[model samples]
Target: MKEKNQWSSKFGFIMASAGAAVGLGAIWKFPYITGMSGGGAFFILFIIFTLLIGLPLLISEYIIGRGAGAEAISAYKKLAPKTLWVWIGRFGVLGCFLLLSFYSVVGGWVVIYTGLSVSGNLLHASADYADIFDKVTGSAGITILGLLLFSLINVIVIALGVRNGIEKANKYMMPLLFLFFIILVIRSVTLSGAMEGLKFFLAPDFSKITRESLLYALGQSFFALAVGFSCLVTYSSYLKKDVSLPFSAGWVVSMNIFVSLLSGLAIFPVVFAYGYQPTEGPGLLFMVLPAAFSQIPLGGVFLSLFLLLFLFATLTSSFSLYEIIVAAFTANRFRSRKIVAWITGLIVFAAAIPAALSSSLLRDFKIFRKSVFDATDYLVSNLMLPIGCLLIAVFIIHKMDKALVREEFFLGGTAKASLFSLWRFLMTWIVPLTIVIVFLSMLGILK
Candidate 1:
């Protein structure tokens, strides 16, 4: 029998898992959402929920993955054989497939912009940035080409397998990502009138705390950590039993939070210094940002670095999505990793075509009165995500043996029993209840 691959070191596992956790949410969504919400108040609530719900779920996945000593689907099967429970992992794989398809399209956008940044087109002072963005998204040829290019990168890296591929990529890229962010933040905070943006981001306004904001914070906690996809399960399966699941989860959570802070600092000050609206949402990253960067000294170079930084973040996240599906197929060793990876890449490229054309050739194509890209994002983000998280929480506390979970969680650490009890209390009650409410609210069923 072939031996299952393990991470070469605990640091490698932490970096890979954290890479899986940090994605576009950290780069694009986190900063914008914080701006729209109550800034520091929303951030604090997000941290609370992340620690309360997201952290426990992460630890649970780690325990499950390492405990079973198998891939995503096989772990469930090994733990609960011949039952419907295996569907949990299957659903995760399916969700990841759909996610990767569209995510790569976004990644392709970054790729095109990165090239433009390097070429100085994206920073042209007289250029209509909004019109340029529209043209980019509205061009079917450009979008699909980007999709193919981005997916190809993942295919090649993933084909190399974990230790040489995902682990190594994250270990190097994450530090570079932070360095880029720090340089941008320094430049941003130095801009005249940047203090207002800093105040808006770091100063908590208790008055901005509302029901909707609370829900946004909760959902961001899940989205920001990439918790719902079960990609962490595949990453954690590579972990050694001696590595502390709790410690790894803590670092992942902390790194994600720090990146979120850096993202806010990097963008909000620039937006405010330029008198641009922070609530520009998705356009803030693609449109307003480039224009803002254009006004700075040697802006083209800085913008190129930022775009490449974003591309790195996007690819890191995409690797996990690819791994979840690829791991399932290669777990039993019937298929070669390289072949399966290329096939997976091809499938994602094909699936992403419609989304790539969503704003262009397929602009008229709508599901549920939304464009294909918007519809897919809604399906995966609102529905599949919550259901996956709910199922994980339920599986750990209800379906799985209580004693084994207890034992697995405490395997490598001398943490307090009170901590385990707290994890149990949250997973058993608070986590599911919050997810259900947040899910319903997102679907407009509760509100």
Candidate 2:
């Protein structure tokens, strides 16, 4: 077996894991989905789920990782009772590949937008801003080019290994991401009528809350926390035993929420400022935000910086996703980790092209006749991620030894016996049951 690499420090592990959680899901997906769904009400529900449902699942993933000391797939064989749970672990690893495939494409968009921002292309754009969005998004070439560039960046980072590659990038890029985020929020929220957007985002609308809304809230929490993806498992496998799981979990959630809310403050104001409907779908960031940026003073500078920072967020995330596969292949001795890493990167690039060209190249592959993006997203986010999380919770809470999990996670000694019971109860019942229901609801199996 290839030698396992450990994080040089606790901070490195936390930052890397948090970087995975704080991906396009936070900066891009959260605001658009919140608006599209309803607004503050949906967001508040999302927050509730994050704290209650998301945190416990995260703890479970961490416990499995630290206890088993392996990648996601092999983690099952180490921790669970029956051989069956290993299948869940395998799906989690597969989900990583699927997630990375399209995520690389989106990451490329951020990189391209950053370059465009630096070139002042955004500043002088004409009044028909929506048309500009159409021009960029409708073109297949731009999308493919963006995916290729992002795939290249991920390959380079993963090849560099943890401390030298992941740690070094997070130490600099994550902080800069926050700085640019704050600056953009300040600028976006100050625009005339921006308060209208802020109200839309933060002021709760109770009417919007429903069973479906609750399920969506749960899904958002999972997506935002990156909880169900086994990324935490892969990442914490590198963590030293002395690190506190509860403490690290709290920091990851807190930092992710801070950044996500700040992203809302940044983007919602711009959406309202531009007179765009809050409910515009996936293209909200690329299409709506650019138009909003065009209207700001020094808009090009602000947007250029923001997009670059956004690229950092996505790059760090892509790095983690790639690591899941790299660890699996390398650990299994299929090839040197480095060779597998390169091959994985190339495969991701090739897979992403169809997604990039879904509206163009692979638009008509009829199975229910969905586009490539639709198919890939359904396979990963809606299916594998939730199932993987459910399995991890089951194995940790039921199949594994309780005393060991408690010892590893509640290392600070301040946690009482009752808290362990509560954690176990939540893991056994609340977390898994919720994920199951949400998974069913998402598939239209429940009314």
Candidate 3:
């Protein structure tokens, strides 16, 4: 048997894990959702649920992975040999596959826009942001090209192996992600009318709170940290025994929240300052952002920087999604990791073609009254993710032994009985129940 790989340093582990957690969920989706879901109130609700739900599940995944010292699927077989708990890992890998399909479609849009920004074509004083966005999404050639290129990037990185590949890529990219974020925030907040955007994003308005806002806020927090899927579990599997799970989890969560807040500060100020609405989905990032940036001095240059920032965040997240799927098959493999990775990339690129054409050639096709891209997003976000999370919570609380959980959790430090109890309480009761309610609401059974 071959020795399992370990992270070169604790910082590399933190960055890779944080890179996994911070992607479209934080920068792209969170800002638009915040705009639609009561702004500051929704932001507050999201933070509350992140602590309650996201953080615990993150810790549980680490405990499961490091405790068992195996990849995602085998981790289950190692711990709960005779039972069907292994299905959870299978489900998570499947979820990631479906996620990356549509996720790559959007990633392609970022690629197209980033290149356009470089040519000074996408953002200019006379450019129409809405038309540019529409053309990009509606053009099959452009969308497919973007998706293919993005998929190739993911494939090459995964082929290079863990330490020399995922870790090294994130170690530089994650810091650049933050640096670009800070620069954008500084530029955005300095614009006239920026204070109004700040107020909308930071000042909680109880009056604007709605049932939908609460639901989205909770769901956003749960999904935003990249916990429902088994990607983090695979990443943590590479960690050394001496690394502190709690401390590492803290850094990932903190990075997630901080990046989310920074995205809001970066985008909302620009949206408000430019007198534009904070629209939802690709429109916000592609349309509204371009329009806002176009109004700034040398906006083309700043827009390129922001797009590059967006590309880095998207790639970092895609790396984890690709890693989990490759790890699933390549564990104990005779075939090369490179071969498995290229095969995985081809599968994703093929699956994502319809999603990339959702706004164009496939515009007439609908699943559950939604476009392919929208339907895929809804399925993963609303159905697959919540179910995956619920199973994880149940497995941790019901199947795993308490002593083992405690030992894995506090392995490098003294056990805090209070923290253990709190985690147990949430996993045993709050986490599962909350997921059930949210799932019910998504199905229109609760409201």
Candidate 4:
């Protein structure tokens, strides 16, 4: 038997999931990637897929969790027979764990950057910021300290429980995040030569919209919206029965997509204004962003504030990831919630070791000549996410009662009914096929 939890309120659920969706992926990665992919064109494709493909999948996870009123593993078991569907739930949880393994390492970078920003170190090093980033990225000590700090923050939040835990943190953090983001975007757009970056970011060149670009857009949409993760399913288990899953999930995905687009607008103009290449990987934020900030008056202050906002975004998302694992333990027979939180945090800390040490001792322990971080990210993003989402689609459409799904999610009259068919078509055809092609492309088989 599982213990049931009711959400504190409607807004609580939205903020919590939105907090999950609005992570480092949005504030930094989205802008960097959009600029790299030819700006406005990629941004437009990303928005299109987010609504078409991401929204439906978001609703599916919410329905699964709310309708079943169970954790991800139990939800699937109750919703599907004992054949292979059970493994879907397991894989979903595994994906969450795998994600946190590297995500925490990145989360640590945010923490480090936040401290550096506050201390005025970021300003001094903007000239050759790549060298500074390389030093941090290469060090095992800094990474471990960062991972530990991230683990501590997430553990504290999860231990706080639902209303006080996830909801309260999001309610406060989300507003500050948006406020700072707006400020950063404004400051970034005002920089000299910023319009050139905005041109690349906002003015779409349709010629660049190749199949690969479209696929990348779709994948990023899903990941950025936090659609494929079982965290939504786990979080939704606490929802009140009367709540409209589709309406709520739509709002969450919408907000996240908006943030991603806004972030691209905020970042590209700055990147272009400064003549920075966007293909700088994880160092994009650390390296290029500093350069852009240096050219502004009181750039360090603004940059510090911006990175702090980025840190808050990453922390909120990391908190949700920890919540998913803790929910499983809390619902299952194990330690108490506090114990589960601590244990889960410790496990994540352990898993993050390889990625943290990737540039050091773990660099040589490579498969296919890639580091641990690369392997883990590739496996999760290319393989686990798509497979997990496919299982979710099958579970929702094939196994669960579509009529009940219609009643729960499609209750917004005729307009919603039309939307439901679009949702069905995308989940059934568009997303799955595109994921397959994207997976092949990532494996070098598409070329």
The candidate scoring highest on TM-score is 3
TM-score of each: 0.92, 0.93, 0.94, 0.90
Tens-digit per-residue lDDT, 70-184, candidate 4? 8887777777756677677677777889999998998888888788888987776336787788888789898899889988988887786657755776787788777766766
* Per-candidate RMSD, Å: 2.3, 2.3, 2.0, 2.8
Candidate 3: Cα lDDT at 70: 81
Q: How does candidate 3 fare on TM-score?
A: 0.94
Sort by lDDT, best first: 3, 1, 2, 4
Total residue pair clashes for candidate 3: 0
lDDT of 1: 0.83
Q: Give the clashing pairs for model 4.
A: none
* lDDT tens readout by residue for model 2, 297-415: 77787778778778888877877788888887777676776678789999989878877777656666644566777667656655666677777787787787878897887874366
Off by over 4 Å in 3: 1-3, 295-298, 441-447
Pairs that collide, model 2: none
Task: Please list the residue runs of candidate 2 whose C-alpha ends up more than 4 Å from where it truly belongs after superposition.
Answer: 1-5, 125-129, 210-212, 295-297, 363-370, 440-447
User: Quick one: best lDDT, which candidate?
Assistant: 3
lDDT of model 2 at position 334: 66
